[model samples]
Target: MNETHRSSTDSSEASHTEDGLSGSFEANEDVEKALLPHMDIKSGPQNIGKETSWLKLCSRWPFLVTFLNISLFIASFTLWLWPAPLRHPFKTQDYWKETSFYSPILERFDIPKISRVTNGTLYDTNPPSVLRQRIGKEADKEWHRIGDHVWPLVIGEADVKQLGKDPRVAVKIPEDLGYGSDAYIAQTEVFHHLHCLDMLRREVSYEHCHQQDISQCLIMTMVTQSTPPTPQTDLKTVVEARTREWHFHIYFLLQSPTETAAALALRDAVLRLRRDGAFVAVPLFRVNEFPIGPHPAGSYEIWVPDSSFSDVFFYLAANRGNLSVLVHPLTSSQRRDHETRNAWMGTPWPIYLDSLPSDGDVPLQYPELGLGWSTSPEQEISLEERLRRGAKVEALLANDPEAAPAPED
Candidate 1:
């Protein structure tokens, strides 16, 4: 009877346990059904917890959400508005614009430097020669120093005094010009000629008429002693001569102020023209203080090539101020070149034709630094006596102190 009681009690406990498990499962289903509408399709237990925490934080500090949104908006707008150039802040435009280059071995003590930023445009405004120097290419050496070589077109005695000790130019103050040394201070042909005429007028007045009656004397002289009409020469057939080279002898009186000034001015003009590359071949300008060979009076020589003959000839014709220019050709016969094969600009002066050699080969001699003539004017040989003379010239020039060095590439 005790064993039957125990078995019934066990059966009752087992039925109760089954009923409790079934009830708990039903309660869990009800809870899930209630929460189904609030949960997202992708939500998991961890994700739902995170979303709930985020919502709680936003509710507690409303300004935090606004600040975050505004910060995001500003950052996006700034990124959009940023220039394209600044997008790649660390990138270089070219190899020349290396922003971070260091060479400890090459420049151990040098301060770190960054190349300038360029936008593929030419911003260099320096002169070509200066620019060349900056890039390590040597600038060209001028034929002569312009400042030291050239004289002014016209300058006063006071101004001349200011320019101390320049030997290339010849300066003089006209003496006994009656109008006192200070009164007449012109260094041009026009003014000098006027001064000469005035002196002659004074002399004529002293000899013939009183100083008060000089004006009437001059008028009478002009009317009575009028020059005869010039005889017109017939236009002859122009023949192109067999010429090698040409010389433009700019004749000036050494002591005369006007002629010397004009000559100096001409020299300056020629040098400037050459500097501008106006001549085909650079002409040599040499001042002859003493009369040499066939050239009378103080003269300067412009040794020009056949190619540059016409340009130089026309230039002298237009610009030879109150002075004489003997444009002569170089031919086989030296005497004929001076006397016969010559043209004159302004008043023709008498050449010492007897002094010139009658028959001889006249080889052209260009200036030592003359362009377009010789690759090496020193080593260059003339057609005649080149073996002895040319070698000596080359040696002399090579050893000369003033010779320009070859330009660097």
Candidate 2:
């Protein structure tokens, strides 16, 4: 009986120890489960309370978030709208003697001076040289004496008169006449000249159609001498002489095989007009035969005297076809003359500068910055020479202590 009691007690004690271990494990598990809501395994030490507070603050003041976003947007927009500083392609050479450096180089090198061969006689370019000074001198003198301007209105003369009588007449090119087509270009040229003429007629005073401005009227009213007025009184005359001296170079750019024939016909018509004494027509120059500096490609050049500027302008205005006419002023600088002060009747044809002599002298004032217009004037340096000279000038400036800038305070 004693042995049986001992076995039963030992079994009870083992059961109690097992039950205690299971209860302790269950309690520890419950505690871990409770703590899991506050802990974040992904975001190292838990800042859940701080994050929640921050989110609540943002919710309370939505305007603060909105303001920050708006400020960022405004800053970005301001940066976009701000204008960039002007960038000059060339560095200004203030002290450099451009004329002196270039002139000798041009003279030494037989640079192709801008000269036009018309009617077998080589006419000097707009700015005359010592060799060909007399070529266009007579025309120039006559122009000065009469106080007249030259306006070469280029277009195919209409068989019928009074076509563009109305200044407001809209130019109507046929839909079938494709771009750069002989018929289309011819029609367009006529339309452009007509429009220009109409505009001029409307703006110009009837009495002073020959003169560009009212300076002639001032001269007539103010001066009382058959003899030329003194330098002091002749300020207006000098000003008029400079400004009013315009030469309208009408160029008919021929492209197609048929267009050459058409151009010839137009040339003949201009000759006819000249024969009839309608106007003094400068001889037709085939651009290909005699490639003048910076002249448009595949074009026929014809000039009108200043005497018949108004009449010829009106006549051509009323009757022109697809020719491209480049009407530019005879300014002091040939480079600027073509570039800055010119009007086109039709789309300007790209000049083939590559075909022309590339190594010829260009003016110091007009540097060859790849602009094809930098042709060697009567007195200028070649593009290659100009570049060499430019490098020398830059080197000289760099070495000179005087050229160095003072440090800012």
Candidate 3:
């Protein structure tokens, strides 16, 4: 009976121990849950404080931030608006800059002050047929008459013994001498010499025949150095030393209103030839933009390589029928290139030789020989003038039904 009572007492003490352990575990879990909320609240306020600080700093230095933004905007705007040419302005002005070094020399010689009255009359108003007929008949007679008097002057046989003898005989100086600056003093000397020759020629001619007015007649000769002298080289040596790649400039001469269709067809044919690797077609120039020498009034130029010269020449010769073609060689001397070596397919036209530039350095390769192709100033037709000319041509064609064939016919 005593052993059973002891067992019941031990069982009751074990149950009380288990209940105490369960209650302690529940209190520990509640404390951990309550601390998690405090940790989350503390982290949230810290993040908010960081963001507020940055906003406060910006608010405090508003003017500084605004100034920085404006400075950046101006820098970007300036970079965008700057001109490409102004960035390297010296490159474009290099030619002028080099020429400026000779300004002192030009001023010392009074080069720019010298001038001459050039023959600036245009006698090309007549149609080609009438002009050709007139040229054929009268050209030889006039050439012969001028040749007699001019030959002596050209050969340096003119009598200058009576040069300073006459007080009334004064050497008239031109005020504007183009290309005269190259050989300023030499040109002046030649002018004086020619004036003396003219006086003598007049006297001798009048003695033979008193029919023509000899008083108003004068022979003007302009002498200039073709190229500037090298430091240790003579003219003959320089001329021989010059080497150039030969190029043939073949020009197809055309006229406005009359040969417009033919010109266009020729241009198309030239372009087709270019595509076939035969020759390169050059752009057609306006009347005013034509080269200074005896080039066709309206024409399209084509560049034929030395290799294709024979082929191009033969083709053009056979196909050019009645169309004027001026084929000239490109040489080291611009003057010589145009004046000396040239072949004419049709009627040769008279060129104003005096109109070309007299003082430029000859190029090693052929240059585009046209107005505005060089630095020299030249007269150019404005857009308005070109438009007006086009309108007039259209008006004339419209009035004359026979000028061109109708589209259907």
Candidate 4:
């Protein structure tokens, strides 16, 4: 009897549970039907089932939906329209006391000591045999006398006659003096200067003959003995506007073989101008394989007289190939001569301006070189003839100096 009672109780509970679910589903359908009139006709009946719950929520609380939409738009717009914040300047904050910071790795490192070695003796004290053989006994004995090299002996007949007629004099030399005919005179200071250089060269042994030592000796001798000219104490001071001389510096790269060869060729061409007794006024120039004075590159100087300035300038401008040329004046003010009164061919180069003097007399003069250069336009060699002779000299210079025939004076 008790078992039958338990089975009957179970069947009754199942029937009640099914009835409750049906009632709940019918209530939801009734709610959806009531909300359908509020929904838009454009939604159509087919979408009613899908949008039923959403439509009921919006109808009950319209302001909540509007507020949520506005909040979402503001968040999105803020993110889109807001400008990017700028980076702040970094400030070192005292995280700990400055004394607390320590770099153990850096403390262990030690700076390496640099050792410098300098060469003291550049040249030998003993004279070379080749240089000894070239020196004359009298010159060797008088090597201490700087004047011996300052003035060389002029024994040539033509040089003496030419010295008398030199244009440097205020008055003409008397024709009756018979300088060339009766007595042979010594050469001018120019030749003497060359002689002195040769004497200095002989002091070093051939094996010990360093170009730097020779150069340094000459520089030291000149610098120690030389003094600037005293300016005249006059009431009226006169400064000449025109330049008396000019320096044409032909530049080349010492490291480049081709450029060096071109430089040598150009030098040879200029030297050729002196051949065949032409362009005698063009003085002997110096070729510097390294930087000297204000020049910053390997260069050679061509000293141009005021009279032959145009001809020489034209020639250099035409001939300087892939090479830079610095044309500057020689004047009382070295700075002004190089800075203001200068021109360039090809590209310009930087020079050591501080090496030049601010105020001084012309550094070099023809009077010091030799007697004087004749400036008579008629006597001056024509540019065409110089060019022709230069070509021939270049050809001759290309061959061995010993093998080549001597160039005519």
Question: Which candidate wins on lDDT?
Answer: 4
Worst 10 residues of 3 by lDDT: 153-162
* lDDT by residue for model 1 (312-349), tens: 88887888879898888776667667876788898898
Query: Global lDDT of each model?
Result: 0.55, 0.45, 0.46, 0.58
Q: How much is 225 displaced in model 1, in angstroms?
A: 38
Clashes in model 4: which pairs?
149-192, 153-187, 154-186, 154-187, 190-369
Residue pairs that clash (backbone atoms under 3 angstroms), model 1: none
Instruction: Give a tens-digit lDDT track for model 3, residues 121-208.
Output: 2333244222112224464344344343332111110111112111123232233644332211222233345445434543453346
What TM-score, computed on C-alpha atoms, does each candidate reach? 0.31, 0.28, 0.29, 0.32
Q: Which candidate has the highest TM-score of all?
A: 4
After TM-score superposition, the amount by which residue 214's alpha carbon in candidate 1 deviates from its true location, in angstroms, is 58
What is candidate 4's lDDT per residue for 119-218, written digit by digit as tens? 2344434553222233467545554454453533324333333233322222333447664433444444434554566556566556665565664565
Segments of candidate 1 deviating more than 4 angstroms? 1-241, 281-285, 367-409
> C-alpha displacement of 141 in model 3, angstroms?
42
Candidate 2 residue runs with Cα over 4 Å from true position: 1-240, 243-254, 284-292, 351-409
RMSD of 2: 30.2
State the displacement of the C-alpha of residue 403, model 1, in Å, after optimal TM-score superposition: 52
